[model samples]
Target chain A: MQDVPELVAQAREGRPRAVARLISLVEGASPQLREVMAALAPLAGNAYVIGVTGSPGVGKSTSTSALVSAYRKAGKRVAVLAVDPSSPFSGGALLGDRVRMSEHASDPGVYIRSMATRGHLGGLAWAAPQAIRVLDAAGCDVILVETVGVGQSEVEIASQADTSVVLLAPGMGDGIQAAKAGILEIGDVYVVNKADRDGADATARELNHMLGLGESRGPGDWRPPIIKTVAARGEGIDEVVEALEKHRAWLEEHDALTRRRARRAAHEVETIAVTTLRERIGDLHGDRRLGALAERIVAGELDPYTAADELVAGLTDGA
Target chain B: MQDVPELVAQAREGRPRAVARLISLVEGASPQLREVMAALAPLAGNAYVIGVTGSPGVGKSTSTSALVSAYRKAGKRVAVLAVDPSSPFSGGALLGDRVRMSEHASDPGVYIRSMATRGHLGGLAWAAPQAIRVLDAAGCDVILVETVGVGQSEVEIASQADTSVVLLAPGMGDGIQAAKAGILEIGDVYVVNKADRDGADATARELNHMLGLGESRGPGDWRPPIIKTVAARGEGIDEVVEALEKHRAWLEEHDALTRRRARRAAHEVETIAVTTLRERIGDLHGDRRLGALAERIVAGELDPYTAADELVAGLTDGA
Candidate 1:
C-alpha cells in the first residue's frame, strides 16, 4: 500500500483511485487510518454534505443521481455516498445504485461510493462520518449521502449532513412508518419522489398533515418544505436544487451551519473514543478478567450490573 | 421506591405490578439496578427463552399469542415481551398485541409487557437482555421475546434466545428480504403464518430452497424446520409448540443449550460494560476536554483519531 500522506495528497488532487483507497481504509479500519485521518484533518470541512434518506423503494438512488446531474450542470464538483446498513450483503444494493448512476461514472467532477456495513464494526454509524471527512477533505463541492431510512442506523446519516432530505413514495405506508421511526424530526427537506404516479398528491398531503400535527413551528424554526419530483425523468430537479441552495443560504445567515458542523465533529470524536473502548474490551476476551467476571455473574455470585461496574473500574484503573 | 431485594422478591412472586416496576427501573437505568440484578441473578437461567421475530405484518404478534396459549395449556407459566426498537411510538404496536393476547390477561400463569427503545441508550440491544433476565427471575417457565426483524437490533434479539423462531407470510417479499438480512442464519425454527393465504406453500418451498443452498447441515447439526400456520384461527399452534419442544430437546442432547446461554451471558455482560463506558463519555459532554479536542480537529491541528486516543487515555488514567 502507498503511504497515507501520498494517498491523501493524490485523493485531494482528484484522483478517483486514491479516493477509493482512502474510503477503503476508512471502512476496513486499516492500520494507517489514524495517519490518514490526521493527514486529511486540515483539508476537511470544504464540502456541503446533503443527506438523502427514506424507506426502501422510495427512489432515493435515482433522486440522488438527478441531484448530482443538476449540481454538475451548475459547474460544481459532487460526490455520492450510498450508505446501506440493513442488507447483510454489503454491496448488493450499492451495485444497483451504481448501475443507476453509471451516467456520471465517467465524469471527472463526480465521485460516487457505496458503503455497505455487513462486517464493519460500529457499522455505518461509525464509518460514514469518517468517510464524509475524507470526501470533504478531497474538495468536493457537494457531498450527497443517500441511505435507506428503514434501519435505526440510517437516522444517524441525517445528523451527519448539513441539510437532510427525507423522501417518501405514494402508497408505501412510509408516511406513518417514517413518523414512527422518528425520521420526521431529522429531515430539513421533505421530498415525495415518483410524483408522477397515482396518489402522489395524497402522499404529499398526508406528509404535510403529519408535519402539521407536531408542535407548531416557531418563526425561528426551519420549517422543512415538501417538494415533489420524478427523479427518473429528471423532472423537478431544478426546484430541488433551488430548495437546497436556499436552505444553504438560510443556514449560513442563521449561523446554524457552523454549529451543526461543530456538533457533528463532537459526535465524531465521542464515537471514536467509545469505539476505542469497545476494542479494548474485545482485547480482554481471551484474558481471564472478563471471563472471570462473566463466570461470577453466571454463577450468581455477582450481579451483571455490579460486575460490569467492577470490570469498567478495573479496565480504567490501569489507564 | 422500594429497596432492590424487596422489589426482586415481589417481582419473583409473580406480582405483575412489581414486575412492571422492576422493568421500569431497568429501562430508566435506575441507581438501584445493580442491586436488583444481584438479587435476580440466582433466579434467572430457569426460563426457556424463545425468540419470535419476523418482518412487520408477518403475524409475529399473533403467533406469539398462540404460542403463549399453547404453553399455558401445557401448564407452563408464560411471559411475553414485545421488543420494538425501530418505533419511537412505544407500546403502539404492543397495544394491538395486548388486545390479541387479552385471553391470557386474567390468567395468573401469563404475564405480558411491551418494551420500546425510545430514548434508551444502546436501544433494545442493551435493554432486552436485562429485561429477559427480569422475566426469567419472575418464575416464568417460558419467556417469549417478540421483535420486528426489519432492523439491525432485531438480530440481537435472536442472539438472546435459546431458540429463535422466524415467522414469514405469503407474498410479502419477506422470503428474500429475510435471506438478505441474514435472518436465515439466526433462525432455529421458521413458521409461515397465514397458511390459508395463497403462496404459503411457495414461501415455505422458497425458504427450504434457500436453506438448502447454504453449506449442508451435518448429521449433528440442527436443521431449522419450516412449518405453516394460520395463527389467527389458532391452527397449527400445537405443531409450533411441538417443534419448539423438539428443538429444545435437540439443543440439550447436543449440549448447545449451555453453550448458548453462556454466550448470551457473555454478550450481556460485555454490553453492560460498554454501555457504562459510553455513559462516562456522555458525562464529559459539558466538559472542555472533549470540546477542546473537537476544536483542534476542526482547526486541522489534531486528527480525530489521535484526539480520540488521547481522550480515551485521559479518561481511563484515573479509573
Candidate 2:
C-alpha cells in the first residue's frame, strides 16, 4: 500500500486501472490519499475547474457531456464528478442523473465519476474538491463538477469554479423563479441548455431582466454571455467554449483571475480546516467525565450551557 | 451585554422579554450568548426537540402550529424556531412562512420565534441551534425546529431532534424520493401530513416499504411509527403526539434514549471543537510566511498540500 505514491504516478501517466484505483482510494477517504496527493500536488494546476449546476432535470449532465465532447475535440482531457445524494444502500439514483451521465463512459478523453452521499450533510463537502484535486493532478486540462440539484449549495458552484455556468432549461418553470434561486448572481457565463425546448427565448429574456437589476454592481463589466444550446444534439458548444475563453481572458484582463485564485485558495484551506475540526470533535466523545457531565445536564441536575463551558475548558481548568 | 447571566436567570424566571433578548444574543452569535449558555445549560434538557421537515410548501408550518397547539393544551410550554433563510441584504425570507404561522402568535403558552437566515447557511448550520438552546434553557417543554427548506445543512435536523417527525404531503412525487433525500432514515415518527389529500395512504405504504427494505435498524423492539395527519383541521395532532410519546417510551424500553442523548452531546461538542479549530486557523491567515507560500503555490512553484502542511506546522524552507 506504500506503493500508493507509485500508483498515483502511474495514474498520472494515464494508466486506466491505476487511475480508477487512485480515484477509488481517494473517494474512500483512504489515509493514503494524502500520500498520493502529497506526491501528485505539484503536478496539479494544469486543470481549470468548471462547475455546472441548476435544478434537477435541467439538462446539466447533458450540457456537461456536450461541453466535454467540445473540450475533447479541442484536444483537452476532462473529468466530471456528477455529485448526488442518492440511496447509498441500493447504489441507485432515485433520480436518473447518474444513468444519463454514463453516456460518456466510452470516451477516452473523458473521466466521469458519480459520487454518492457520504456520512455528513452539505454534499460530501470534501469529496468533490478532493476528486477535482486528483483529476488536476492526473493532468486533465479541465475538470467539471456538476453539482447536486438546485438550492443553497447550488449557488456555491460559482464560488468553486474558475468558470461557472448555471445550466437552465426553459420548460421546467419560469426563469424569474430560477433567477430568484439566486443562481443568476454566480454565473460567469449563462448557459440556456435544451434550447430547442419551448419558451427558451422567454427564459433568456427574463434572465436578462433579472441580471439587469444589478446595475449597482458596476455597469455590466461581465455581461454573462448567454449561450443557447441543445446539448443532446451538441449545438452551441463552440460558442460556449469561446465564451468561457473570453471570460478567462476577462478574468486575467481585470486581475480578477488573481483575486479568484486567492479566494479559491482561502476556500480550500477553510474546507480542510473545518473538516479537521469536525474529526477532532468526533474524538473527544470518549472522555467519560464529559459524557457523564452531559448526561447530568440533560437530566436537569446541572445546566447545559455551564456544562458545555466547563467541559471545553476542563482539561486545563487549573492552568 | 455582560449581564447575560442575569438575563438568563430572568428568562428562567419566565420573563418573555428576557427570553427573547437571550435568544437574540445567542442566534446572533454575540459574545454574551456564551455567558448566558454558561448559566443556562442545566436548564436545556427538559425540552424535547421535535423536528418537522419535508418539501417546501408541503404545509410544514401548519403542521407545526397544530402540534404546538396540541402540546400547549397538554400543559406544556412550546417554542417553535420557524427557520427561514433570509436574503443576505434585506434579511427577509424568500417567502414568509411566519405569515402562514400567524394563528399561533397571540397565544402566550406558545412562543413562536421566526429566525432570519444569517451569514450561516440559512441558520441551520449554526444560528438555529443557538436559538433552540436559548428556548430550551428558558424552560420550553417542547422545542419544534420547523425546517427552513431542505438542503445540505437542513438534514442536520435529524441529529438535532430527540424525535424526528418527517412531514410529507400526499403524492409528493413518490415516497421513495423522500427516502433518497435521507428523510426515511432520519425520522423516528413519520407524519404523512395533509392525509386529507389523496394518495396519503400510498405515500405511507411506500415509506413503510422503504423502512422494511433495510432502512430502520434500531433495537427493532418498536417500529419507527408512521402517523397520518391533516394538520389544518387539527384532525391528527393527538395521534402525532401519541406517536411521539410511544417512540419516547420505546427508546426507554430499549434504552436507545441513552444512545441518542450520547449522540446529541457528541454532535454539540464536535461543533464547538470544529469552531475553535477554525478560529485557530483564521488567526494564521495574515502571516507573512503564509503569504509567501500562497504566492509560491499560486505561481506553480509549490504544491498546496505541502503548503498546507508547512503552514500548519509553522515551517518555512524559505531564506
TM-score per prediction, in order, is 0.81, 0.77
In lDDT terms, how accurate is model 2?
0.69
What is the C-alpha lDDT profile of model 1 across A1-319, one tens digit per residue?
Answer: 6688888888889888888889888778998888788888999987999999988888888898899999999999898888875422224112334467778867889888778764755778889998889989998999999888867778887766999999999888778989987788888889999999999999998999998845686787777888999999999889888888888998999998877877788888888888888887787777788777777666667778877777777778655
In CAPRI terms, model 2 is classed as acceptable
Single out the weakest 10-residue window by summed lDDT for candidate 2 chain A: A87-96
* lDDT: worst 10-residue window of model 1 chain B: B87-96
- For model 1, the stretches where C-alpha displacement exceeds 4 angstroms are A53-75, A84-107, A165-184, A187-243, A286-289, A314-319, B53-75, B84-103, B148-152, B165-183, B187-220, B223-250, B317-319
TM-score of chain B of each: 0.93, 0.86
Evaluate fnat for each of the predicted models and list the values in order: 0.74, 0.32
Error of 1 at B155 (Å): 4.4
TM-score of every candidate's chain A? 0.92, 0.85
What local lDDT does model 1 show for residue B228?
92
Best-matching candidate per lDDT: 1
lDDT of the candidates, in the order given: 0.82, 0.69
